[model samples]
Target: MANPTGSSLLVIERLLRDRDGIWRQIIEERDLKQLTVQMLTSSALSLALYGAVLGASNGPLQAVSSFVKLPLLFLATLAICLPTLYLFNLVFGAKLSVLQALTLIMVTITVTAVLTLAFAPISLFFLITAQSYPFFKLLNVAILVLTALVGLRFLTAGMTALNDHQLKVASRPPALPPAVELPADKPAAAKENGAVLTAPAPVKRLSDIGGRPGELPPGERPASMTLLYIWILLFGFVGTQLAWTLRPFFGSPDKPFQLFRSIGGTFYADILQTIGRLIGG
Candidate 1:
């Protein structure tokens, strides 16, 4: 097994080039420490990249806030969504272990952070050439949206790959070995008494309902789709709300440096208002 702690770059490389392999490693090894390390490293670098761009317009203090905000957005969103995701996976028969689930989410965040970092140079270019606050804010918003979509592609693909792997494993026939008989003395006493204790009932699973392992019932397909849609919505909602809570990454031209703006409007409303002011003024 590769040492996940010794090198974060190797993990990132595997994530980009061999996602299925990384997922298998995480599942087989039952390790998340490397994933956690990667998340922290990627998030920190993303903060620095974002701060570099924001510092061009917002000054040192606002740049510092940029450093703080992305981490807040990532961690807060994860904290808010983790429980719901775990429950949905449990109910929908995903068969993910706790470590597997945590690593999957960590991979998503790390990928997003890396993608954001990749866009930093472009953001800096706009910061230098475009002085309008709306332009800067909108541009970064667009960059984040693109990065998020790419990152989410990994999440969906990873889920599908895991499901496929599960099906392959489940479809294989179990090997049957010769059975051993119970000792004659115990059986004889039980037969004379005319009493036999029933065997313990097997625990039921969501996947066991009218289907083999890794195969869902016909009705369950729609429920799984619904859960996926809800999961996507929950991710977006939490991220947007957390971003709002950690406001001022672009820093307003009129206002002085402050860590947060008063929470009053929806994120979408604010974006529209910024766009209108940029165009009208």
Candidate 2:
């Protein structure tokens, strides 16, 4: 939140720290529900953004039609967004209102537009205007990335600072320093072989998990759907990537093709096997 313009970067930094338990209280109670929502939202945003980047690579200028006057387009957008955002913020207090969020977004886009408009004069130094299109586009992306990165770094630093404070507080020594922790200088006994033999690592603080420690024992509610979804995503993502990488060489008899596919196939198989073993295959 230190820099609103780099919202993605800031959010990412928070997510990283949250993964490290910074905002676990705000999220863990719902059993990672917030984390799932955030992941989905971030994925949606990234898909939209990268899609735009891919589209702009071909011809950004030609992509816009005659009726789509850039300046008027921006004006109309801001005019619609700012009012909506402000009203929503006033009413529900959620940040997503276009007036609230989009005002800054519009301004950012306008800056890019102004930079583009100004680039024409700079283009005179070069003969081929068409060839310079990529350069101009690259410049815009660079500007956006720099601003986003700065905001993100600030947010990340903030999250880290808060997390350290929480961890320290949660871990402070009790007045007597709990003789129970020493447990006769040895672990409690274990009845079953292959079971973890020691006392559990202080079960990650209750406040950190947004509930009392041991609040929900095994027989309580099931874990979460997000864990399953994450696994599914990784399974498909890794499988597809592997298939794509080896496709050309999969059936080839040429010098390195077979060797390459064999090695790649072995790598993937080993990965899947390791995963299976870890999950009690």
Candidate 3:
């Protein structure tokens, strides 16, 4: 039997260093359940660790709250948006299965979580050295945004890879029948009025004509990819709003620790308010 620990480690290693292989697995619909489980486990742990750092700015109780909420934030966002992505692809003639879609999104989340974890130490340093709560909030927010962007880039790349693979498969020419041997006595070329006639050169297929590797032909990209890009923007909007809704991740230093805060302002407005406070102070 395969060691579960080793399998999980391998999955994380592949996510970090062999993303192309992961994309291939998703496209091929191989071991999707296993991939999803491993990704979820790794991302949850990473996000929880990062969340602990964010909450550490307040106190231990807030740290525990963040450790729980951070993973919930990402996974909840994924749950909310997963159906839209799958249906969008389905409506646009993409053959992506639900499992495939889930795995792909997991790829995004795992990357984002892992990258955020990598930034945890820096965030912890700021937490210790910087006394201003607003500045610390903005710093962590910036880190999350940067890491999410990188994760979304990976998602775009994976979709592009899937589209290219599909195009190649679709453009493949039908197999021709084996040629019949001609008699030695017969002329290789047809004769018309004692003039030799030859066949015209075979037409080259669009697939046969090559350009730069990994680039799709003009107008060949599916509508699904475009929809996916738009969906990513929607994802950002949804995630930020959700984060605001699940506030108190970084409890204010001035206020007593609370598991949740009253929701009133938009996330962008809050950021602006925080920026103003940061600047004024």
Among all candidates shown, the one with the greatest TM-score = 3
User: Alpha-carbon error at 232 in model 1, in Å?
Assistant: 1.5
Off by over 4 Å in 3: 1-6, 177-223
lDDT tens digits, residue span 39-101, model 1: 667666775677557645778788877777767778888888988888888787667766676
For each candidate in the order shown, give its overall lDDT on alpha carbons.
0.72, 0.36, 0.84
Which digits, one per residue and each the tens of the lDDT, describe model 2 over residues 1-281? 34322343244444434433423333223323333334334433432343233223333432232113323333444444445334433453222223213323332333334333334333323313444433433343344345434433433343344335444444553244223333465557544456545554453444565655434322232222233234324433443354334332112112221212333554446445545654562
Please report the candidate that would top lDDT against the real structure: 3
Q: What is the lDDT of residue 173 in candidate 3?
A: 62
Error of 1 at 126 (Å): 1.0
In candidate 2, residue 4 scores what lDDT?
23
TM-score order of candidates, top first: 3, 1, 2
Look at candidate 1 and tell me the lDDT of residue 143: 87
Candidate 2 deviant stretches above 4 angstroms:
1-31, 57-131, 170-281
lDDT score for candidate 2 against the true structure: 0.36
Please list the residue runs of candidate 1 whose C-alpha ends up more than 4 Å from where it truly belongs after superposition.
1-6, 179-225
Give the winner by lDDT: 1 or 2.
1
Winner by lDDT between candidate 3 and candidate 2: 3
Residue pairs clashing in model 1 are none
